[model samples]
Target: MSITSRITGSKHTFDSVREVLAKANEEKSGDQLAGIAADSEAERIAAKDALGSLSLETLRESPVVPYEDDEVTRVIQDGVDEAAYDRLKDWTVSELREFLVDEQTREPEIARIRPGLTSEMVAAVAKLMSNMDLIQAASKMQVTARCNNTIGAEGTLSFRLQPNDPSDDVENIRHSIREGLSYGVGDAVIGINPVEDNAERTKRLLDVTKEFIETWDVPTQNCVLSHLTTQMEAVRQGGSADLLFQSLAGTEAGNEGFGIDVDLLDEAYEFGKEHCTASGPNIMYFETGQGSELSSDAHAGVDQVTLEARCYGLAKRYDPFLVNTVVGFIGPEYLYDGRQVIRAGLEDVFMGKLTGIPMGIDACYTNHIQADQNDIENLAVLLTAAGSNYFITVPMGDDTMLNYQSNSYHDASALWDIFDMGPAPEFETWLESMELMEDGRLTAHAGDPTRFLEGDR
Candidate 1:
């Protein structure tokens, strides 16, 4: 059905809910590249006006991709809490945004209404929110999860120690992990993105990371960021892993490009649950970004923001311990510059937390993108202030293997110091025991990898 909005006597009509959602988005290069973004800012505002008036029921009834045709839509529609939806379905998208940002809307209230919301609704509310609006609304809903230790606890921020080697060399990767640990990072997970995506290489990476964690008694988990199938094979072959990692997309076709389907994901999740070495529950790790669906040509004419929210909706089904958007890594085609990247980062985290999963950010950029370290650093600070569960920190903000710049190992400690936050409780205790950190600040020996050598403990 066509929806029309009149602003200042100018009437703007969108042909479908899909058109309204796409046009309402803040300027994004990917949407424009897809030939779906609004042509003018006035039209964009008009689309927002129409979207804000669209009832939750309308959005629910209007799946971006028909349920019969797409598993992603089927999963989202089937997963809704019918009882909760029944209560809030009549409310307009404007009301939903108000409910989320209302001063009285606490975590429990948000949780109560979350099941009623769909990815489109989440994206709708996000579109109407300002950057700080997104931050304020998300700060109220701190969804914590646990694998080895608790993450997303209030007054705490965690960092994933990404010790990726360009050549998939175990010893070099091991030393990078040590360096990150010495600086009091890696409380979230010591994850590696392997140069080789095969099972043997994945197994080797997992084994090396697990051995280091055991040797140092680090209160964290280990994951090799290879394909889920590869990781499953690694685990089956007796390579230890605490978490299974995969990159997810918003659509079934996008997932196909990634060589994954819901069934394969479910099988891998079950396998990780039964065989992986982590503690109780929350064993899956997922990475998403704004334009993955578009990159795979599976966006279904929807805006990147909405498709991104659907990714979180899919992730919620597995109860993942960690889910992060590699926000700026996709490059300028989807998120043109610093402003767009920052906006997407905030929007993704807000949507992820609103979906009731642990959320983090890999505030990163590629060399070809019109962004730099300063932009990524700015994003890290904003996300940290927004109470993100974690951040991805590679050594010195550069991943030679991935050829991108992310937040640095030193950036994590700097943020902790700036924001008066510490690592996960269990990890902080371990850090104190090792004298790497004291009184929530890095100690003198904090940056030395050699401190962990030769049974220094």
Candidate 2:
């Protein structure tokens, strides 16, 4: 009936029993005895419940804590005076359209509210504007130029040469690079996520890539998509890389899981900036996306989109040369379908560009999703028309290594041709020298010269 008797099956007091156990064995045995006593107490409580001797208290929910507003929210709230915002909100849709067309009236207000505007509001406003007006608005939002100034300068295009082989064989990777460059890709950056992630392999890949860059004299950079720590290790071991790369999340724990903290990131950035051989705005490359916060269990009650924007703020602090939002790579639990994916992709680009970060879209989808290459094309075209910085073009627009399909090298060429756009300045000059471009048009050297139809080819 007593606690000590219930646990130890002996007629000893609890304190005496604990002291005896501790003396006989060690402090650990005493702790075990304490656990037995606690279990016995729990059983007694359950016995009382069986006898209907327990009283119940009414349950009350805790107060909900409000999210701490971010700088973008605070800035927008401050810039749009309450009275003006209310009046503007009440204006007829047509009146809003006309106001948006007038640069003097629209730019100031739009810039203020743009950070906080919902996707629906953006879509509604976009529906009323002409193509030219949309392009102009996107241009006004540009803060940082990226990818050798071609992206923000002249709607430049580029792709990722993901030699995702497990061995990371030098010959295979070299062939892929040759093929991509032969078609005028890599203007943005020829980045690879090496299958075997280690300092030696990454260094080998970078060395081979540098050799190709030098051999071909292409005006582009090479990146091995490894963790920032691994990249730093490679650099320290005398491995050459043009850019340091990592996938970053919004929260500290999430970043720490990837072996990076803000201080580590700053160190990597400084090292790349000092050692970079490529011609670009900056030397650090970062990849981020929505759902990563939730996936990493670091969302902290903030919406995914807002958390993603905060990541951009973190990335901006380092002045990265490239910040790509791999919009749908995490799949449908966060985005659900193609419609959500498209909207999120647009919203990410808009937010990233507005925040003064060099932005690119890894307009991609997993096989398990309802999206496909067509969905990517739709987002890519819309973003391109809205002055997106760059895109990741894989072989045939399908990533054999990552097992997903994205925009292809041909897709980049098509967007250029349809919009009459060209590559970045330095890249364009290189392409002209290689005869990939002539008279502002992508020559046969830029794509399939036979121009075969889909089935015919």
Candidate 3:
């Protein structure tokens, strides 16, 4: 190969290494060839190949980029009367929710629920937020809850009946919860889980959840149906979700917990046909522990098998456009062993394949590892490669607050940056080194336990 040395203020190409070496030698250069410039073609070619490989890895990690920037904006603008996002910029959760609900109510097909807040209401506001994107929040919105008490332990808060019945006094309760939650900081997904035994009771529970959800003057895109209904085969088969919506469009709750025995596949399909509205929100999510420890109840051990089954069932039941599921890790325990963490995640993928539901993850943890740039990027690459489309974690920067922290405000920008590399130097390093693992798993740099990855399946 030819190497060339560039003269001052000159661009030159070297075809022969020897010639460049001879010139350098004459210049009394040290034993090493100091001032020579090699053709960058080789490096360029290597980088190209490397980036191509990394792109494939990223794709494998997150397959669903459903709301592209333009698409999100277009849908929002077209569907919601094109309220200049600029005018509604920096609005809080409640403000944004209100904007979308108001816009959605204009559509004759969708109903609106500008329900006033009340103490008895358990609010479950469904939202799809993004950065620098047009969000079609003006679509259908629905919130569902099961007042039956089968979900929680016998003595737990959810197991006991709350002061108000969601069905009998939903409107006032919902108003109270909405007002109360908006006063606090944290995303509100409030819903009641009443203890109910049989299908009839379960149906009654769902009916209560539905009745409360339907009272607002505004339209609901879809109800955030709790996993309680997901447990009822009868409810799953009974057209509960469709029956709940003006548009019959919304999610069927179940991907989060395993207790619900409803054949997700059968129920989702039937629900889709009878009540699933074209514009309703549709996605389910399940849990994975950060510590790698499974709970004794329905959520034990981040059961990939159960997760996969649920995913497969959902996919079989609904078209890609109608149904989606997210599998997530919630505790620090799942992070205890990077390898195990990935294994649990892959099981989720296996479930997704079996059932055919698009998957995402909501990374929630009580104690997250504090990381430097390299550590953060490395973790991102590894986790993404292991089949995580969405990562909901603590934000980076000076903000001391964390998500799900007791009354702490989560920085929207930090959450946005979790998986987004932006233009960081270490991010490039992590991207380039994504495939390098000791046991086919990524690990944090020496002395950094916060970062990790997978080694083998």
Measured by lDDT, the strongest candidate is: 1
TM accuracy, model 3: 0.31
Better candidate by lDDT, 2 or 3? 2
The runs of at least 3 residues in candidate 3 whose Cα sits more than 4 Å from the true structure, single-residue gaps closed, are 1-213, 217-264, 275-317, 320-334, 337-360, 366-457
Candidate 1, which ten residues in sequence have the lowest lDDT sum?
Answer: 448-457
Which model scores highest in TM-score?
1
Candidate 2 lDDT at 25 equals 18
Against the reference, the lDDT scores of all candidates come to: 0.92, 0.61, 0.27
The residue-by-residue lDDT of candidate 2 on 27-65, one tens digit each, is 111123223222344433332222121111000000001
Candidate 2 has what TM-score? 0.70
Write the residue-wise lDDT of candidate 1 on 1-457 in tens digits. 9899999899999999999999999999999999999999999999999999999999999988788988888888889999999999999999998988899999999989888888988988899999999999988998999999999999999999999888988788878988899888998999999888899999888888888889888889999998999999988899999999999999999999999999999898889889989994899999999999999898888889999999998998899999999887878999989899999999999999999889998999998888888999899888888889999999998999998999889887889988999999999999998988888888998999998885765
Model 3 global lDDT (CA atoms, 0 to 1): 0.27
Cα shift from native, residue 31, model 1 (Å): 0.2
Decide which is better by TM-score, 2 or 3. Answer: 2
Which wins on lDDT, candidate 1 or candidate 3?
1
Best-to-worst order by TM-score is 1, 2, 3
Worst lDDT window (10 residues) for model 3? Answer: 118-127
Q: Write the per-residue lDDT of candidate 3 for residues 1-457, one digit (tens) a residue.
A: 3333233444444333222221211111111122221234343232222222221112122211122422211221222222332332233323433444455343232222221111000011111112101113311222122111011111111101111233434454344333322221011122232333345544554454445334421122223333434433435555243322111111122222343322543455455545543233342223322111133232221122222332333233333322212222343332333333333333343223222233333322233522233333333344343333233222221113222221111222233244332111222233234322223222233222112211211
